[model samples]
Target chain A: MNAFPPVPEMVAAVRSKRVAPDHFVTESLRRLEQHGGTLGAVLSLTKERAQADLAPLSARLAGGEDLPLAGVPIAIKDNICVRGTTTTCGSRILESYRPPYDATAVERLVRAGAVIVAKTNLDEFAMGSSTENSAFFPAKNPWDLARVPGGSSGGSASVVAAALVPAALGSETGGSVRQPAAFTGIAGLKPTYGRVSRYGLVAFGSSLDQIGTFARTAADAALIHAVIAGRDPRDATSSDHPVEPNQARSMDLKGLRVGIPKEGHDSAIDARIRARLSATQERLLAAGAVIRELSLPHAKYAIPTYYIVATAEASSNLARHDGMHCGVAAPPEKDLLHQYLRNRAQGFGAEVTRRILLGTFCLSSGYYDAYYERAMRVRSLLARDYRAAFEQVDVLLGPTTPTPAFKHGEKTSDPLQMYLADVLTAGANLAGVPALSIRAGHLTEGGSELPIGLQLTGPAWSENLLFRVGAAIESYWPEADRLPPFVRSQA
Target chain B: MIDENLVRSVAHLARIAIPEARVPGLAKELAHIVEYVDQLAALDVQGVAPLTHTNAGANVYREDEVAPSLPVEAVMALAPARSGNFYRVPKVIGDA
Candidate 1:
């Protein structure tokens, strides 16, 4: 069965009046209502808000305003603030909290004529590798219902892969977008750290957080990226660099140096996934790109270093939800200090609590130099490795994850095992570079065929280069165009 | 290894209330993570400057001119407990 039409084609159809904007909105809401519950993908449906915004959108289109995404329906992860709508961040702490302003990325999408149809579910405060850490419910994989859709962006990935909306927005501190995108066959792009503004994305790891896009094709991902990227004065870290137009129809790879990092192909990668990576490399070679082998010695240390740095930042960022400032408070105590302690204990979930405790321990007086400071020093080493590699090659290629999607409860029981999920993807975040995960091929496990993703990394502010190469991979290795069983059954 | 007593003190420092029953389990979990991350100790990180921000962008300056800000009512709308223009928290001082 054919999947949803590419975002560009959908926009063309809408502009020509072949399909009305309301038609897209109505259809998306219908599918979301039908499948969202069973798949555990949606946190809240913004049907009322979406309908309220339709009139002004129609007026703009009639006024000949150039809206590139005119009438397209889209989903925002729950952690992103949407004005007058509940932005839970998949935690009970802020279950009723509503931001008075829109996130910078969400604001841009609305200005471009995209309708916000729903707030998708997520791991609480965007911390886990699986949606099981979600305070509400675990989002399931569309390919095999019993398995997990890799997360903290699992719901966003599931909806896009199931062709519910065409595309959605997800955030990545460490592999949240790419891992889920790999699990559910699609394209996930984590732009260079400051490439997209983080003005309104709920902070997880302040220094590492980035908002990314999810779509069935790399070209469509580029369309969304162009709208949301670039500087916003509110976000100090957002780059002032001009947004380069990266929607090339085809790219020439002759003499383009692609590096295959020896560290990325170690025994830690599943044998089948390693085979898929090798095949992806052959295609690049056939296209005239010279493949070079290299080393990143510090790559093995990324996971531990990321956990320390990320948890430390998270501990500091989450301190504001003290119940007195905002979010739900625990039952009143005799004194303010007890109230503060009770509020946090009752509000945050297990993983969140564990992280906060770990973060506090790392930054505490006695252990500061041993844990937090040392991690930062190692973080510098990771960044140095990326700098050295970029000097030799234009792009680096590797597996997006060690293996395909595992069973939901498989890794949840072991926190260390869960942390290992981001082993291959965290180095990019630590070094602050752009990485794109695209469907390379599929591997069969049991009676089901699971998708494998090939990742491409480049130096900071190289989004255009990354997207151009990503589009090339999707052209020849076109597994992204196929629909998952859930969508096929509906047909 | 992180002992249960250390876990309790850390939780206290972090301002999180932990039930006596949950402390042992939490202690074990924290210990595993701490030990796993201890692998960094083996590397000689002497004299290497800690990298805080990945992108080396420095202080961002803007105009000092005042601009429109969110209304007080809008900002206080999400507060769990609020008095007239103030967040109402539990009493801070104890009666003699």
Candidate 2:
């Protein structure tokens, strides 16, 4: 029940039998009811409402409505709001909060006949690299239950990799989507900044956050991305550029130059992850992608710079959540001071509180220049390096993360270690490029199954090119549907 | 390195209360970040122009226009406390 049927297989199922949406939803619900809480991925399942919504779509399909996403069920991160459903951002403060309107991404899926199944958990406000910071529950890696699924999009990645959902929508403020995708062994793409509209997404580090998608394959990702991404008058940051067909890019990597950053190759990465990445390079070379070595001298500074800028922006965006006015309302005391203070003290979680403080410190008078300004300067150098690399090569290659997935709480004691874990993903965000993480290989024969991802970073709006190369690599070595033992046990 | 008091002060400014027990932990954690950032002082970036971290060459622009914002009432409605047209809140500054 948990094995991921390829996107074509699911579509064929819909087209061949005109699978009833109710029947499809019922089966998924049964799988979800038995398996969801254990994974800690699903926050709230819209069983009653989703079933009713699926009924009409089922009827339409039975009547021969050829909806592209007809009968397809998808999950969205809690940060991306779906109207009438709770969008908590995995914080206690937002637990009862519901968006008055749907996010552009949600609207796209709903309009395309996709069933809104559930809102998945995420790190509180997408601040942490791992989902352990979620106030509700930390999502466990589906592969090894003790391990993390990566984050702040951990729940989104876990559900897809575990085959609970075919695809999911996630957001990346640094490596939130890609890292989780890499850790959980799923296909994930972070579109160019402003390529996707920010309207209706709960804002956190607005300048850095881009809505990305996660799927079992690259083609499925492009299809979902094409549906949601485009210009919208609702969001000023949204580009007026016509939505280009990001799909249709085929397995053509011939004559493409893929750059391997000299610094990206670290001896510290797990040996198995390195083996998979090296093998992926061989496959790309076989397809005629010339691999070149380039140096980003300022790559070391990416982590600090990302945090400074991201957290500073996050501080400003989250300011509206003052308990006095927005989010969860506390008791009205006689004095405004007690009312606001008590509300805030009780509302925010430990992780959210810690970030707000760090962000506040960075943005405060007398220190902004030393921290925020300097960090901005550092970010520029990283971008400059990428620009130079792009002049010579079409894409850059590296391991998506230093390691695949770590046991939960291993890095919780030291936040710096956790921040450092994003070393590979942060540089791409700072460079403002379209980057993706795709599973390249597995380890340990039959008994022990470990997955590792190879990352590709391209110039802005070059996701189509990345897919071309991705499809080539995937073609050379067709990735089997690798599911965890837990799912198999259920079947 | 960041001291315990700085952590407490920052926490207060952010309106988040850290129990006394957690302050020591946060202070230790924050000190590592501050210590690592100090490495920048060793670099010789005297004359280099600050790079634009927003590396993408394309400036995704939309024609500027005035549009309807969230209805003032609806926005104010999200506020836990409101007074007339304004949101009610604790005085950020000292009371006169």
Candidate 3:
């Protein structure tokens, strides 16, 4: 039995009556149970809920209806609300909270005939680079059990990498989705901001947050992206642009202009990872694509600008989480103010508290002009840089993360170091353009091989182009379909 | 540099309590992060307008029609303290 069939294959199998939807879901649940413990990829499994949810899809199939994603089991990141299921942002504040309504993306997935089998783990409130900030246990990378799965979408990426699920939904604020995907050697896409509705997604940064997908293949990611990309009235920030469905076109790299930004090749990047990126460029050139060196002069300001803008928005968004309205509440205190303070302090993890404080400081009265406003101005400069670069080239390519996945506690002690993990990927988010991370090659270190990702970023509303380029690049990797060692052993 | 007092003030503004002992360490970390982000000061953003949202659409208004809202009971159920369809909170005004 194939453990990780791409989305189209699963659809074709279901259509041909080769596999029953019920049976497929059961097998997926069994595998999730088998591997979830070691990987810590799943926080909660909704076996009964998934069976109930699949009844209608099974009936539709029996009734001769062709569903785009018939019987495909997908996992949801804990931050995205799944109605009637626990939506804990990997934080204790909302430990027992159940959202009353499904996020638009989740609702659309259900309509597309996808069954959500599990709610995966993540960093506390999706705040950290490594999943270590999870109030629960950190998710371990499938490639190396001792190392972390890059986060805050760590569990979403880990499950897909481990073949526990064919695809999963994760929300990206900065590099939450792509970084983890790079670490796990999966395809993850952060669609252009406003491409996907954010109505039910727990907000990290209102302007920067976007719902994304994770899958083994770029084609599968594109399929999922198409289902959830349309505008929704419920989200005022959602664009009214029409969704462009992924046309399963052949991989044609001819005539595509690829740009390599000098700023992307930072000194901090691992030498081996840099070499892998160079090799990818060579492959693209050989495929008849034009490669040129480009410069994003203001790209260096991405990290600082992203942190300031994201945190400022976060402070405002998170202000609603006081214990009075919902979530975990502290026992009644002497007054409302004390109650809020105690409840928040006890409920939020250390990293979450730190971010809240930082955000508060940035938006403080005296510091607002010097910090928040200045960061916004610099953010404009960074976006302008991308706009200018895109005019000269179709897309920009670079290593997804500065280095491969690191050990669990390697950078947790230093918060700034942790922030730098998103340095390479944050530019795409800051520019509000679509970007994808595809497995490029592997780095061998100390007898173990770790996967690396090549990120392709394009202009706004250019998801289709990004996917086309990603699919072309994905075809060149000979061992692209090989499962992680742990997954191979289990299979 | 961010000091313990600044950290305390920020935490107070955010309405999250920080332990007195943890303030020193939190202050140190916050200072480090601030120092790193301070690099933005070197950039020349003289006349650039802040880009708050990526798109140019503003005032995305919809018809003022009544729509189905979450039932009061459901909304009340999520609250920590509620009394007969109203969320109950501690009194803000004290007796004069």
Query: lDDT of all predictions, in order shown?
Result: 0.89, 0.78, 0.88
Q: What is the TM-score of each candidate against the true structure?
A: 0.98, 0.91, 0.98
State in Å the error of residue A186, model 1. 0.5
TM-score of chain A of each: 0.98, 0.94, 0.98
Q: Quality of candidate 2's docking, in CAPRI categories? A: acceptable
The residue pairs in collision within model 1 are none
| Cand. 3 TM to true fold | 0.98
In candidate 1, how many Å is residue A338 off? 0.8
Chain B TM per candidate, please?
0.91, 0.65, 0.92
- Report clash pairs, candidate 2: A325-B79, A325-B80, A380-B51
C-alpha lDDT (0 to 100) for residue A367 of candidate 3: 92
For model 1, residues A1-491, the per-residue Cα lDDT tens digits are 24668888888888888898777888888899999988899999989778877768768888899889888888999999888889999998888888988999999998999889999999999989888899999999998988888999999999998888888999999999999999998999999988899988999998999999998888889899999999999899998888987574458988989999997688989899898888878998999999999999999999999999999999999998787767764578999999989888888999999999999999999999999999999999989999999999999999999989999899988899999999999999999999999887688898887888889999988877888888888777666567777888884
Q: Which ranges of candidate 2 are over 4 A from the true structure?
A: A2-4, A15-17, A48-66, A326-328, A445-448, A476-480, B44-96
Q: A173-242, model 2: which lDDT tens digit per residue?
A: 8899999988887889998877888887889988788899998878778777888888776766666556
Give the Cα-based TM-score of candidate 2 against the true structure: 0.91
Model 3: residue A396 alpha-carbon error in angstroms: 0.7
Q: What is the TM-score of chain B in candidate 1?
A: 0.91
lDDT of 3 at B57: 81
What DockQ does each prediction reach against the true complex? Answer: 0.83, 0.41, 0.78
lDDT tens digits, residues A1-491, model 3?
25567789888887777888766677789889989889998999978669778878767887887578888899999999988888889988888788888999999988888898999999998998889999989999999998888999999999999999999999899999999999989999999999999989999999999999999988899999998898899999899887776764446788889999986676778988888788888999998999989999888788888888888898888888876777744567777788888888888999888888988999999999889999989888889999999999999999899989999899988988899899988888888999999988577776767888989999989989888889888887867667888988875
